[model samples]
Target chain A: MRTHRFAGYLFILPALLFFLAFLVYPLLHTVYLSLTEWAGFDLKKITFVGFDNFKLIPPDWIFWKAMRNTFYFVVGTTVFLNLFGLGLALFLNNSTRFTHVVRTLVFIPVLLSPVIVGVMWSRIFDPFGVLNQILEKLGLIQTPIFWLGAKNMALVSIIGATVWQWVGYDMVLYLTGLQQIPEELYEAAMIDGANRWQMFRRVTVPLLKGVATMVILLNFIGGVRIFDLVYVMTKGGPNHNTEVLATHLYEVAFWFNKMGYASVISVIILAISLVFAYLRSRLMSEEKA
Target chain B: MRKTWILLALLLLCATLMLPAAPKTTLRLWSWNNEGDYPAVFEQIIARFETANPNAEVEIQWVPYTEYNEKLKATIAAGDYPEIPEIHPIHPGSPMYSLYQAGELLSLNDALKTGFPKYFPSALADLTFEGNTYSIPLDVNNLTVFYNKNIFKKVGQKIPETVDDLISLGKALKAGGYMGIAHGAKDGWPAGDLYFQMLAYSDGSHTMLRKADFGKLTWNRPEFIEAALQILKMNANGVFPPGTAAVDYFTGAVQLFTQQKTAMFYPAGSWIVGGFDTGFPEGVEYGLFPFPRISKVQDSASTGGVATNWGVLKKAKNQDLVLAFYRIAADMKSAQILIDHSMIPPYAVNIQAKREILADMIKAQAIAQTRFVFTPELHSQVMSGVQGLFTGEVSAAQFVAALDRVEKTIKR
Candidate 1:
């Protein structure tokens, strides 16, 4: 028994070392960096400023704007992704030949890199692009709309692109969850004189609680750390209208060379993600109970 | 037999040890100038350098222009930068300035004192920071209106010489169902350059601009606000292509101009001459003209400076080899290579213009003014403000106010 336990420890030692080296060490270093004033060069030259970086965060309007934008993306993506994912899953539950083709077609966007998605969507939303031409043919408006250029529409456009790419992923996850729920549950509900809506509400919703929690949590976290699409499309531009926490952090660290302040922003993002994770775990536990 | 074999091995070892080993050194250079004729130009220069120093080799790393600055910064932060890094757009607020401030660049004052090619005074001034020259200016360029002669002829429009004339021409072009100017405001720098040109024309000299940059003057001054308003006015008049705010420089403006989707001209730098020569469609005859003066009373000022230059890292191992390469690069031979490729070498060599447009560009560069300096934070803010103006997100006063707010936050 002792030998077997030692072998198991030895088997996992490499992964443990990798986890410590890559994850734990960087997290700790980032925390240390948040307290210092460093230009991200010359590790020896990092000056300990002790909460000064964090203090600067409150008065910085751009940082607050980025936070607000991130919040909007997270909430917006979560709601839409869940709504669409569950709807598509329920619709495609029958698994016909046509439904299979539709599933594959919808999943195509999920397989594309975010950078490619951003570029493709940018063209589609271009003022003189196909969308505008179609609208013009319909005589919907006199002039072209600046989808990515307009301050109000830029973030919304980014959100739309992100949801398009990830909705298929959510649908697939929900389908797996939906398949596991036995038909007997629906039959039992129907035998009790429950209508179609009541059957769906009482049986489907109750059974898929675990998968819904996972899908929503995954989306919330993904939205919080969103960077590449916003970067490639508008670059958080048109006057920082689409600026999010990740892109702002990138600009601060790389462009402005304010590594320490960027680290602070990173810590804030981590904190938000942790709080969400904790809430998710609580929800899961409560559901289990 | 064993004794004979051992004696032969001993003799072979002795002969190998007696022969002197060849000395070799490798010089690494990083640059964002990887497009068009730049690679061939660099190759020719490196071949000359290698021929002159038989034992020395040059390795060039070409980074894409968009990601070059960020990559350079990150590599330097990681303490892994190349020995000779090219610092482009060598102005007061450029990456060269930041690198110099961090004491990462090698001061070339002593090296430049002797046996160096003579550069234009203005070009040298742009590369110098606080009485110390950090980089050798490779080339200088200025913004000019690149117009398709065919489109201008079709529209029966003459070149505009003043701001008002340009506005009227833009309106006329728009009325004819053509895009007046195909500006790519997405990259931010192009729009910023246009605004700076407006400022230069408004102020005549860069005095107020310099003062505002150094925090000695407020950015919300009438001249600055006027420049902002001018850009907004151009946008409002349909002077720019639709979706101009979202369009990027290369894929948007350059493509539109080359494809004849826009009429009249594009406000861009002279560096694009070489690219346009190759990229422009057949029968797309183009011409160069200076940026129109804001007022007839004011002299037309071209906004540009040294577009390409190189600096040595302080921690470079092969400083002697790097200096040797620089000496070769600064020679008239290298200048001829760049000139042949349509680049304006900083050297004062007599330019025998191969193309009529190149001659016009050289003339425009003669009266070129250096762009206004800004701190990195302030520069980013100004770029955002310019984009906002084009996108109708902010008005001229609002843009100026935003600049003032950012300027106030910078500590000296």
Candidate 2:
């Protein structure tokens, strides 16, 4: 038993070191930096302006706008991505050659670089873009609805793109979990005259609870942290409407030369991440129990 | 496990392959050129410089516009950098106030004492730290309001002579399909500069700046709050388009102007001249205006400083080459070509300073009598708070209070 524990520690050591160096170290340092006014680049001289940075938080509406956009994106994507993923997972869990090909194709978006996805989608949302051109030809409406033009609609477009990229990832995770379920149990249930919904609810869903918990948590984390696609596509613009935490943090630290304030926001984000992670793991435990 | 290790190794390989190894030859340039398409200009400039001087080559990179100071801080921490970046668009001036205290950038007073004064005295003088010029200007840009001549003609709104004329005339123009003026409130800088125009004309050039310089926190001064209120008043009058606050300078200007949605777009001359047709949209009948002075304002004759300038990075490998490049680029001949192409050329000795296309633009510059109106530093500081005020998220008093707070914080 001791030997097995030792082997486990050895196996985990590299990952633990990586997490400490990249994640933990940065988090701790950022928390420290949050209390000081360092012009982000110069480390030697950081004026300790404790609490002043935090006080500026209330007036910084752009910061709140970003956080709001992040939440909306997270919630919107989390719900839709799970649904689409589950639908895809169940459709392909008993895959034939055709379904396997379809699954692989659906996963192609995940394979594509996020920056490329953003750029391509931005082109699609252009006023005379392919999607609009096609929709117009189909007699969908008289005039094109500006996808990224209006402030509210811009957030919707980002949500759409994010869900599209992540649905496959969620689907693959659920599919893996689905593959582990015993076929005999489902067959037995059917033989006992359980209907499709009944088998799904009583057996499949209850069994997949652990996977569902993880997927939702992962989706939540991803939704909050999303930056690149939003940055590239909208840049939180048409009047700073779509701005989120990561992008705003980048602006504050780098653009505005307010490293202290940026660090405070970073620490807040870290706290949020940790809370979500804890809740996720707890939910996972409850589901398993 | 085998597949995962192989995949991890492959990923590492790809990451390593992506970062460019340090070059065999060394040249360092610090520029504000961030857009991918526009980096081509620097490439051309670098290629020309390299051809002229064969011993060294160049590497071009971008600094995030917002976190530029942070990147500069990191470079400072790194102990050695090739050269400092040039022409930081929004530098608050008082260079190295903190950095100088730490001994970062060099004082370039010697360069200023030379004939460099003759090239761009105003640009050189403004960036002077403690009565000495510390940076050489590569170029100068000024804010020029480009009205769609077609829109102006349709609206029959001749150039507004006073703020009230604008308010009244713009309303009548709003009855036409075109927006009276397209600049909006949500955008931080445009609306802020619009106030700068008002303040410059009203002898408020140093209203906020004095507060900032003296650390007095006087943003509640009647004129300062009233300046933003004037803009909001115009916005409320529907002088700008419906949903005006939502439009960015780029979208509100180019997007609307191209669609004939509005009558005027206020952007700097560098953007106004040829930039629109190539990148944004094709031609709309365009003409330039100096920032309009209100009818009875005391300093209506002064121009606001929206100058684009160049500076040398301390670690720049080809500092002499960059200096030489500026000398050539700022020459009268080059300035003429720019003016002939419809630019409001800022070089003092420029060849085409007398050109007809640039006549009104030049006249406006000549009329910018107070001259201090242009730096935009105070305007830059108070813009966001003002934008918040414009958006109704804060009251006018709250907006002034925000500026008052900034004045307390940043005033050296």
Candidate 3:
């Protein structure tokens, strides 16, 4: 018992150190920063104004608008990503040579960096860009409606770009789950006169619930933190219509140097992330049981 | 005999080692973007100084324009100040002014007396803070109107000379399915410039920027509300694209004009012919115009000076080389090179008409419009809030009110 305890401590020390340095310390420091104004620099002066920065955000309607945009992004990406990822996995799990190529192609978008994806797609979606040019040549619309310019569609446009870049990531997770599924179960279902749809609905889905649930939960936390894609595409613009919480925190901190106000935002974002993560993991576990 | 020979060999080796040490100490200099993104002419001058002072070796480090400010700030914060850098204060939200209040900016007034009297006077004004000269402005880039001749020709609207003509021209161009004025409001700076240009109309450039300061929440004031009204009218006139709130500057508005999708654009002098590819139709005649105010103001023609300025870090290691670089940068040879690269001269010049394609911009510049020096702090406030006003999302009242509320927060 003494040896086991000592070995456990030795095994965890490296991970604990990493967590302390990168995670716990930063989180606590940021919380402390929220109480005092420090623009990530300027050690000379720090003004303490507890909860005042939080109070200031509500009156600034743009903050609420940005929150709303983030909510839209989270819900939009999370729900669709799970469905599409699972669908692709189920279709490609047959393990034939042709299916290997299909699986490889399905997983390609996950490899691209979000910033590069944003820049490349901006050209594809521009007025005279390849997309509009192709569409015009095909005589689709009379004139080019700027993909990023239209206030009504800009958020959706960003979502489309983000989903294009991440659906592959979700699909790969589902593929791993599909592979773990036993061959005998499907064979048994076929013998019992279970059609492909019935097998998928009953055996395949129930067994893969663990993987699907994990993927969605992980994606939800990531979804809320989405910044680079939206920032590069729209910059929360057309009047904070596409602004998310992370970008808002950045503007308050870097642009305005309202370190205290920025910290309050950072704390709020962290809290939201924690709550979402906890709820997602709970729901996934309950479904499996 | 053996002892004498060893002594002679040692002395000869010592003499050879000291020969290469005759040159002056070497300094490393960095410049941001040959694309003329620099608000001052520092790099072009440094090259000339190296020619005159052969003993002093200066190495130039080329940094890309896009993230130059970010990278430069990181370098300075790490205490690695380059010998010759055109510094801008980061606190006013340009990322350069933040370093200024921290006392990282090196003062330069004592060095500029006889050596740089003909130095662009406004350049000195830009770098000045708390009655001390902190930077030297190589040139001042006042705002100008860039109009597309192709769109003007197609719409049959002759170029507008006066304020009313500009507005009416916008209305007619919209009817013709062409956007008349397309400066991006997606970013804060251009959006604030949009509103400031109106204030330039109401109170003139000098009073609007310098006197009626944005330090207070003058939201309830008539002037503040009227400033918003100008924005609403211009936006309502349908001169901007339908979804302008989403467009970022440079990548958005500049591209629209360059691509011939928009008829007119109002931007700082940094952009125009050289900002992008000038590959317009062979007959396309681009032109520049001064800011037109309400015909009734005391100074109806005054426009704001929206120039980028450079300064030296306070603890810079190589002051002599940097100052030497600044002096030779304003020489005529450097000035001619700047002109050839599609930039206007910061110093006084007799611009000959024969110098290629920039005659229109030069001609418009001669009208002698007064300039308002927009400090970085005020510029930051405008950049942070101006975009919201233009999208018709935040009313001018809300925009100014927000500015007033935050000004006290950041000013401290």
Candidate 4:
């Protein structure tokens, strides 16, 4: 037993080493950085300021705006991505050739580069772009609606594109979860005269809790770290309405040359993600009980 | 005896082959020239340089203009910058000066004095901050408007010489089923450039811009407020293209202007004039005009000078070879290449502008009373304020207040 324990430790050593080196070290360093002030680029320029960087964020209007926008993105992306993914998984859960083909088609968007996705969606949202052209042809609107150009519609448009990109990812996770349920349970539900909706609510949902927890946490974390699409699409613009935590941190670090302030923002993001993940895991554990 | 003779011959051949073939040096040059045939032009120039100097090789890393500065900053931050990285000219208020203050750049004054004697002093002064020159300019640039004369004629309008004239002309063009101006205000720089040009006509000049950069002048100053108000008025009066906030400078404005979808294109003259040869439609006559002078502002000036420049890294290895590359970069051949690309060469060389509009641009640059500030941060602040004004997110007063707040924060 002692030899087996040693072997198990040896087996985990590489991953533990990697985690410490890449993840833990960076996290600790970032925390250290949050306590100091440094213009990014040259470690020697760092000045220890001790929580002043954190203090500055609460009063910054842009930071508040970014937080509000980030909250919208996180909530919107998490709910919509999960809903659409589950819907897709349910509709295409069959093992038929047609369903497989449809699944492949749906997942094609996930394979596309994010930069390309951002640019493509930007063009689609253009005043003279295909979306406007189609909407006009359908008699939905008379004038061109600048989808990405208007502050009201820009975040919604980004949310829609993000859902479109990530739904397939969640759908695949859900499909696997669905397949894991026993056929006998559904048979017994039918024997008891529980209809499709009843069975889904009682059996399918409870059974899928673990997968749902994983997907929600993943989506929430992704929403917190969202940057590339925002970078490419509007650059958090049409008057900085689309600014999220990641893009704001980027602007502070690179554009504003406030690396220390950016580090503080990063810590906030980490803390938010951790609290979210912990709450979710606890809920999952309670569901299991 | 035969074996010994063979061995001696082989040794001689080995010694001859290993005699250090001119100490070939490879220098990495970073540039923000990731657009149509500009990279090709640089490649051609590098080829010429390599041919002239057999021992030197230059590898070009073409970063897109949008991400160039951020990437450069990251590289600097990580202490992994290239030897001959591109630096914007040394306006004291610019990010380049900030980099200099951080000791990131090597002083290039000696190299410039030794290798590029003909480089204009006024231009050199633009890149010098507090007794140290940070970069050697790649080219000089001036901001102006290029208008499609045919479209103007169709609308029965002459080139606008004043702000009111521009607005009126824009109205006329819109009525004629064309865009008034192909402006990519979405990119921020276009709008910033417009404000800077307008600022030059006001009490604000390069000095005022520099003052704003150093937190000496507030954005709520009368001159700045006047400039901001004028810009807001221009946007309100429809002086830009439809969906102006959605348009990008390169793919939108340049493309639309080249395709004759817009009547006017305002951007950097030196950079935009090159499109006339390559992308512009055949027989589409265009004319150049200086940025229209505002009616209320007394001072008159234009925005131009050595804009894009390059500096050696403080940790740059092979300083002599890098200087050699600078010599090649600033030589007459390189100047000729720049002239070919519609850029004003730093050295004194007579360029016969092929287009009449380009000729006007060159003449205007030569005779301008003052130049715009090369400070990126000032321009960025102005851009955000102007954008806020355009979007009705902030009133002119609020915009100025926000700018003042930024000045305070950055100063801290």
Query: What tens-digit string does per-residue lDDT give for candidate 4 at A55-100?
Result: 7876677788889999999999999999999999989988999999
Ranking by TM-score: 1, 4, 3, 2
Ranking by DockQ: 1, 4, 3, 2
Per-residue CA lDDT of model 2 for B153-246, tens digit only, reads 7777787766677777677776775566666444566666666666565455545544443454466777766666766676677666654444
Q: What's model 1's lDDT at B61?
A: 92
The most accurate candidate by TM-score is 1
lDDT scores in order: 0.83, 0.65, 0.68, 0.78
lDDT of 1 by residue, B1-412 (tens): 9999999999999999998978678778898888667778889999999999999888999887667777876788787868778875333445445566677888789999877988889888877777788889877888878888888888889988887788888877776767777787887788788888889877755788777777778888889999998888877877788778787777767777787778644566656766677778788898878778777877777888887788888876888888888888888888888888787888678758688877777778888887746567777888889998987879999988988887766544
lDDT of 3 by residue, B1-412 (tens): 9999999999999989877767575776666645443433445565568778877777767775535655666676677877766555332444555666676776666876746636455445545666777766555555667787678888898866555667788888878877777677656567766666676566543344453343433445667667677777667766566656656666777877777778877764644565644545567667766665556334534343324345667788767767776777666776675666566665666655443345555444444333432334345445545555554557767767665664544443
Better of 1 and 2 by TM-score: 1
What DockQ, between 0 and 1, does each candidate earn?
0.54, 0.12, 0.38, 0.45
Docking class of 2: incorrect
Q: What are the runs in model 1 whose C-alpha is more than 4 Å off?
A: A1-8, B1-24, B65-70, B73-79, B88-98
lDDT of 3 by residue, A1-289 (tens): 9999999999999999999999999999889888886654455667777777777776766578788888888888888888787887777778799988977787787888888998887767765567877888899977776677655667888888887788888888988988888999999999999998999899988988788778877877897888888777766765566789988776666555567888888898899889978987798778757
| Candidate 2 residue-wise lDDT at A188 | 98
Chain A, candidate 1, TM-score of 0.97
What pairs collide in candidate 4? A41-B77
- TM-score quality measure for candidate 3: 0.85
